[model samples]
Target: MAALMLQGTGSDVGKSVLVAGLCRAFANRGLSVRPFKPQNMSNNAAVTADGGEIGRAQATQAIACRVEPSVDMNPVLLKPQGDRTSQLIVRGRVRGTLAAARWREGRAGLLVDVLDSFERLSAGCDLVVVEGAGSPAEINLRDGDIANMGFARAADIPVILVGDIDRGGVIASLVGTRAVIDPADAAMIHGFLINKFRGDPALFDDGYRAIEARSGWRGYGVVPWLADAGRLPSEDAVILERSAMSTGRRVTIACPITPRIANFDDLDPLRLEPGVSLLMIPPGTAIPDVDMIILAGSKATIPDLAFVRAEGWDIDIRAHHRRGKPVLGLCGGYQMLGRSIADPHGIEGPAGTVEGLGLLDIDTILTATKTLERVEGIAGGARFAGYEMHMGETHGAGLAQPVGHRADGSPEGAISADGLVAGSYVHGLLALAEQRAVWLARIGVDAVGPDHGASIDAALDAIAATLERHLDLDAMLALAQRAGHAATNG
Candidate 1:
């Protein structure tokens, strides 16, 4: 099989985006190309056509490759829950939960499943560009690591290391990684690409020469940071970047940063609204005086609550509530708006009870059983489909009710007594344009949220166009084919 792997110097070094770009670039050259990640750790996941959940980055790459996203693309996914434990997903389905130590010991066998899927995809595609996870030189994790050099070595794939210059230490990161990686893993790397560079490329001439000499690798090129990357919906929640909301009658929802945030993409639909803004406020940033405040989804409710307290955002939220402005929360965010959140089992943090923002007069108890479901319902006279994945049961007085019903007409979630403040287990309800317009109209704005699926498709198309502008994708595919041929001969 013809396969090429993109390894990184470190995590968040723009490897995911580059793989997506390369997938698009290769597909544009009339070659069937697929994107693969042997393993992924992300809370931001997308529901596939097969009713499975996988990392959003692979889904985005699937879109770029103009192929249907499947479980095979991301064979193993790790969603961090709390403590040292993570929810393990195999082939886009929840396998079970595992602590870090146990997971590391068990991961080698899981790679067999990953390679089976990769082989299936390779059989059909002309080329497959696999994206590696984290840094290859994570020594402690290397033995069982299936996402980096291990996967590449197993598949006998040639690797291209990507370094993020914008993060600083581009030289050290590249040199250090090459120096520390196992001989076999290091040998797999055929070249290096410098990414996210700003200012003149000419200025980095000396640095590029230095990196090539020290690392003994070919310098493919130095790519400038693409400012228009905001046009795409990011799959990683931690890299949230604030953009200006379009001027008009807009309701800006301020999301206070939480440590273990999940599904932050819940607000992405609002981003498409011409007159609606979704502002993510990090700690220490003053809550902008805005139309509404939205507490976003979180994985660790109690610890995030503590973070809210530490940042003094608790006071800002209370003040917003007193002003009678509408406030909304989803899942863990919902738990935080309640009067109290109990975690006796310490599923999220130190065993204790904590007071919530108290905006909803509700009480929440973190439980061992997690609810994971996808369904459609009416919200404020609009139809929408969303999913609920959480480990908490919420109950309270003056709680709002869900707008619609399931097949049995059972109440699924809650809303406020005044119908202004609300909370729900559902994520992605706002992605429905009609529902978003109804909410915006209440805030005195005649805005219509764009169709989210269409926006994603457009973004993918745009990504393909951008990558086509740069990169010698045809040559890359030729290189992969040649490498595969060489491996077969050896």
Candidate 2:
């Protein structure tokens, strides 16, 4: 009945990845393990097979544990929006938007529901490994903090503080983090794990002792830097940085790095292609004359649309259309290419009117009723099956219907005239081998070199195999079992 919480010294300290590793490790021990994050801030989301929304990290963790993902895994998801506001998702659906200050003041009331979900999941599982967001030492925002220390404190779960030594000053980072957290919160950290250590673990022997000595915390093990994580479906938008092109072929995509980008995973399949170079042009970068320009999904579509206009990318996109280059949009990106996007429910921004790029002549009205479903659809005359989660509806006579069919052979997305601009609510449309290969072929890039899904699965297996080599699974399970027993007693 006890849970073990994994807290990091800071954000991006490998907490998510470590939690995933632990989940796989526990499952390998024949224990039914589940992953939990009371709250998460991520735009990379995954639509469960049942049509619910959850953080992609949790989804990946579910994959690691070989289980189906549910909303209980990540009860609260905060996706950043422009102007100090964020789009809040609760119980796998969009609740509304709240400024950071307002959210902090109002979120405490929701912790009960979050704990209810956790309790429900914990009841059915032999072990649950909870992942913490950000850092426990963020003193300023700890009042309503149910994600890290707060969640651990509420659940009475023992914590394993993971620090990134590769980022330098691991000892200081761990010790300082421990020093700043409130006493009650700090007491929950039963041990610490040094992750992403590059060089010899023996060389940092003194540093490990320094952290243990300085913080008075136990050292689990120094996990080496894992390079095989490429095998998993990435949940971080920053993964686009690794996309490269082969010698003669390339895929040119213009993705405006807005203040709140979401569902950026739509570009993943392109990154794996040796012949495709996925170019994510920021605001000031010239919209290069490329084969295609992709408008990715966004959490804050209304404002991000204005951003596209402000950065003059809208003009560039229009030019690309005029020049007969192919352009594709997904989810929010699809909404932006339409004639108009109306926010009647104040979901994304202040209740207002926003004009779309007018490329599709469709009008989308934002509604409180979210459209979340696992859809099978057609795109560019290809059969594609994917999930769709959105809050807007599009309708117009000039709108182009879907080109692909679902499992039942039903048409699902919108393909414009001349088929130059295509839009879909599906995020992973390219994960299908033929879909990607055909898209790449259209863009003058060859993508038939490797099967994308098999390659990704192999990569995930490699990451798991690598971590299995580095960490002691038996020791970790013993740690969790000890924590769970203590939690039950407490």
Who wins the TM-score comparison? 2
Error of 1 at 237 (Å): 4.2
Against the true structure, what is each candidate's TM-score?
0.85, 0.93
Candidate 1 stretches with Cα past 4 Å from truth are 101-106, 199-214, 241-251, 274-277, 284-288, 306-315, 338-370, 392-400, 405-412, 485-490
Cα lDDT tens digits, model 1, 106-148, are 9999989998989888888888999998888788889977998
User: For candidate 2, what is the lDDT?
Assistant: 0.79
**Candidate 1: which pairs clash?**
400-414, 400-415, 400-416, 401-415
Model 2 TM-score (2 dp): 0.93
lDDT values, one for every candidate? 0.80, 0.79
The 10-residue segment with the lowest total lDDT in model 1: 241-250
RMSD of 1: 3.6
lDDT of 1 at 276: 69
